[model samples]
Target chain A: MTSAVELDHVTVRFGAFTAVQDATLSIEAGEFFSFLGPSGCGKTTLLRTISGFIEPSEGQVRIGGTDMRGLGPNRRPTALIFQNLALFPMMSVAENIAYGLRVRGVSRSARREVAERLLDLIALPGHADKRVDELSGGQKQRVAIARALAVEPKVLLLDEPLSALDLKLRQHMRNELRAIQRRVGITFIYITHDQGEALAMSDRIAVMNRGVIEQVADGRTLYEAPRTAFVASFVGENNAFVGTVAEADRDRALVTTAAGPLSGRNLRNLMRTSEAVLFVRPEAVVLGEGPLTGRATEVAYEGILTHATFELDGGGRMTATIPRGAPVPKPGAAVRLGYDPADALVLPREGFAHA
Target chain B: MHSSVGHWLILALPVAVVLFYAAMALLDRRRAPGARPVSFVQRNGIAVSTYLVVAVGVWTVLLIVLPQLYMIDLSFRPRLPPTQMGGPNDVYTLENYRFFLYGSTRSTAAWNTIHLKAFALTILASVAITFLNLLLCYPIAFYMAKAASTTRMRLLMLMLIAPYWVNEILRAFAIRVLLASSGVVNQALMGLGLVSEPVDFLGLDLGLYAGLSYAYLLMMVFPLYNAIESLDRNQIEAARDLGGPWWHIHLFVVVPHAKPGIASGCTLVFMLTAGALAAPQILGGPRTLWFTPIVYDRFYQAFNWPQGAAYAFLLLVACIVFVLATMRVCRLSLGEITR
Candidate 1:
């Protein structure tokens, strides 16, 4: 909570390939910030750059107002929990935790004492003597957390540490990881290709793609208002429409869509003309007798909500998210669908836009 | 290129068949996870039989059916008609091995024979060299696996392995020239006034053994390289990060991970040198007697077909024993070490 890490237009390149490009994000003290993306999206590269595993091709990384240039990973005020966790197979749990302190020349007795306390903090009080190879997956995860925290780093970096675990365990670990991070009160720079993990854990998330940061916002802001189509499509499900603007004015626009006329409020368009792509969340779309009539083609049961894709008479597929317990129409049933016109968040279609 | 049409057919036919089978397997896998799945008897029967047949095929091709039928049968057959010596069949006996084991009155016994000694020395030397080679190769391998993971590191690795381009015999002879009395090593020493007279290294056994060792060093180097190369560097780094210093890191991390590599490399070097006759004969002079030479002498030098076959069979038996021992030592059946 006492330190903030800043990446100043940082870009990382390996030979000819750019891993991260001109990424500038300011993470506040004690904030749990996540870099979220699909695989090969450079979110991991950004996290590594922050950790000093990589030096930016163009700018600087700063911690607590100090330039992190010329600092190696070991020398930085950071501790990184690698994606694989990378726990030493040979050492006992306590010795693993004491690694950083030992590197700093602490005495054996003192390091062990600190390790025991950290072990307790991670909720595994008596596993200090066990080799990492002997511990279960969850225990090993806790030990990795304790080891990273042992150095008393100002910032902790995690790279998809839960990706290897089963779904149930991963869900459980998220709560544990969040609780641990909260207790530690250190800035956490977490990276993952999982949107659910990123959304569930982060105070804020930076959506990245092809070596560029697409958007940096809190989970709610990101979910409710994604600035780009990629972020909207990636972070959550949204049905999109390519249509010409039937009308455009201040705080309102009517788009003549494939499924027919649609109007929305407060939607911005940098496009010169009406032929722009519009995006609307499936949940925002309401189902009833309205201007548009389409046959329900499919229904997907998601335990809580049923997602129905409707094929309109005009040859366009529009989806609606209805509550699972609701009176769902059978497939091939002709139905009318509508939505709150104000909820349609129109976005420009740019192939290279940072979504 | 030698089998142009045949090669293309060989390549394409297999790939097409594999693809077709793979598609079938995928469909089966997907269908198995569904309701009213494929019948258990049919499913399990195919899986079991396919694995059994493949395993049997591999065993026959590599072991069971091939050697006993082809090579052993070749050895049992006389190179010529043997009716004069014995019955029409010239019944199999230890005579071929006896001639190799105990040569003609003029020739020394197999133990005393120079080529026999050289072969035995080569086997023993290759094994001894593997232990020492690990010491040198480990660090280089570690560097390639961990520190030099960058482009420049990969380039440096290519450079290290580049020596393989030169023929192995040329490399051995190069060492021989350097060790020669008037060659670069002696000349440099004399120029440095380290000795008043040239050292007689090449005319001796020590110099020859040294050449043989250096020449086969690359053999150990590559296998050891592959072992160390494929090692997950993070495992070692993880060990080090867990407070392991320079030396213990290897004991706890590097060495254990490279065990399979070590065993395989050792087996390769040991087996190669076990049957080897050329390197020692060229470098170690006439004093060394290798086993392969005894078998050859019994076959060609002496008119003893039975004893020669026996000697060849004995050599083959020794190799088989070694392979079996290697399997046990390397824990091959465990499927981790060799793989």
Candidate 2:
């Protein structure tokens, strides 16, 4: 089957500033894809380009293998849920959902039936007559989703629809959104700056930085084996040790840091004396005796884990998470930290610098 | 004098209510902690509050309420010679109002057709002018509010308002110059071969409509801009994204949101056009007899203040009725429109 949406080297420029530069990706049908980045990082611009609100200055946007050139947002087979949801305050919930159908010349009764069904899909069965302002934040979000879904487009684009909700509701709606996407069986393209939200909901995520798509992978792969240093630090917490490679092999390399020589897996093969940075996940750093030593600066006790920050004797800081029931080091105590060679990633020093 | 007591009481009710509220505010000085925030009177101190109340009360009573009351009183009395000022001939009566229906007795119609026709036509013309202004202004308002950059909006606003800086009478004459038989508009039309002869714009009442519409164009545009500017742009985009065409988007999303503004603009334009005297006198042809000109003839030319008061009161009533009807049709309240 053809991909649900494809961007062929799409570059959107507003005068001299390039918002999305040479972004190319393929989203399969029925996939929950996400574009994750910080604010002004071009995720929204890319989404608008796909939705046809904006035409890319260069390159083609294809939906279901058809080039969508010169088509407006209304002409495209996609709908966007704005960051504010943008529910029509003057319209009833059902009317808002049925607006797309109404524009398509659907009869009122048929539109009502579709609205009722989508209301049920969003678990808002009896809220058909409620005004948009009558809904709570999360309900507005579901209504926005339902309104987008009502068009029955091949792809639904969401621009951080849950950013306004409180934390607990946001978390709950994340699962609700994922479940709705599953039941609808249509491609969902969600944009968010929240890495946790992107990781929790997306089937395949594209990590973007400075208008560039750094890496696209599944949640697990993106967290564990990021291709670039920006993605490694952006996706999750990490302790980065900047150093030069002292020795190299096929899969492992020894990097000489200020503290001592640290050995890690060399994903980007580098020869001797090449500059590299070794990345170790907080959980992967063992607190007992090892090659690296530091003074424990601060210890924070979370429910399931205690995070210990260390001022490294080598002139940097590192954090380690001790699991529940493990001994967390005291602040001001000298501590030794280590990580397994397979758990650490030594990447080239020059990787994906943010503009 | 005895019958006027009811009118006096009707006039006093608003003043009484204001005083009662002020007294209540001044008396409710004792308060529990955080029971409620201090009243305006207490917050500003009693002297300052009283000063403000007295100032507003004096202005309203002297400037607005008193003149209207005197007009109402005069409308109910008969016109008389100076020698018979307080005589039985000067007694209160409905004769001034009955003058409007004088010719009815000679004809089958219920009222004097000439006067009534002029009044009805004046109202109808005002309504038409209000509608024309709305149509012409909605697009400009929307463009200024949503489409134009700040500099462009400022430039458009300056262009719209600069012409108004000249006196209303001067502007009407300017339109007269453009719309006369041998004016530039006719000259251009004849030059372009659109017409073989000059169109009688003033005789056809087209010049009057254009002049009144121009006079109140800002009144319509500003209210509409204020309303449409506050509308979340996303709603329009959402409508467009839902496959709505331009008209559908405006009808479903923009128009409904701008109802209060539309109502306010329509009310202002309708009232102003209905009551306009200068523009009508300057631009109106000999054929057109607007209602205000009749009122002016009664007061100044005819020296009949009672009948003029009656006609002015009737016009005011019509304006009020139009305002209420507009509010009802637009499903808005007075507060909403004012806001």
TM-score of each: 0.68, 0.95
Backbone clashes under 3 angstroms, per model: 18, 0
Residue B264 of model 1, lDDT score: 65
Single out the weakest 10-residue window by summed lDDT for candidate 2 chain B: B102-111
DockQ of candidate 2 compared with the true complex = 0.85
Query: Which residue runs does candidate 2 get wrong by more than 4 Å?
Result: A271-274, A351-355, B1-14, B17-37, B103-110
Model 1 alpha-carbon miss at residue A193, Å: 2.4
Best by TM-score: 2
- With candidate 2 superimposed using the best TM-score fit, by how many Å does residue A16's alpha carbon deviate from the native? 1.0
Q: What does the lDDT read for residue A251 in candidate 1?
A: 72
Evaluate residue A186 in candidate 1 and report its C-alpha lDDT on the 0 to 100 scale: 86
Expressed as tens digits, the lDDT of each residue in A259-351 for candidate 1 is 787776535554336555667788887887666799999988888999899998877788988987787879999998878777776666664
lDDT of 2: 0.90
- Writing each residue's lDDT as its tens digit, candidate 2 over A228-328 gives 87888888999888889999998999999876789999887889999888889999999887888899999999999999999998778899999999988
DockQ in order: 0.15, 0.85
lDDT of 1 by residue, B1-339 (tens): 222433344445544765898799778788876566665447769778788768875775547544443444445444455444333544443333443445442344344355455445655665566566666666766676666758967687677667768776676677778877788989999999999888877556656556545555556666666766766665654444334467766665567667777666666666666666655555555455556666667668976555566666766677667667867865565355457
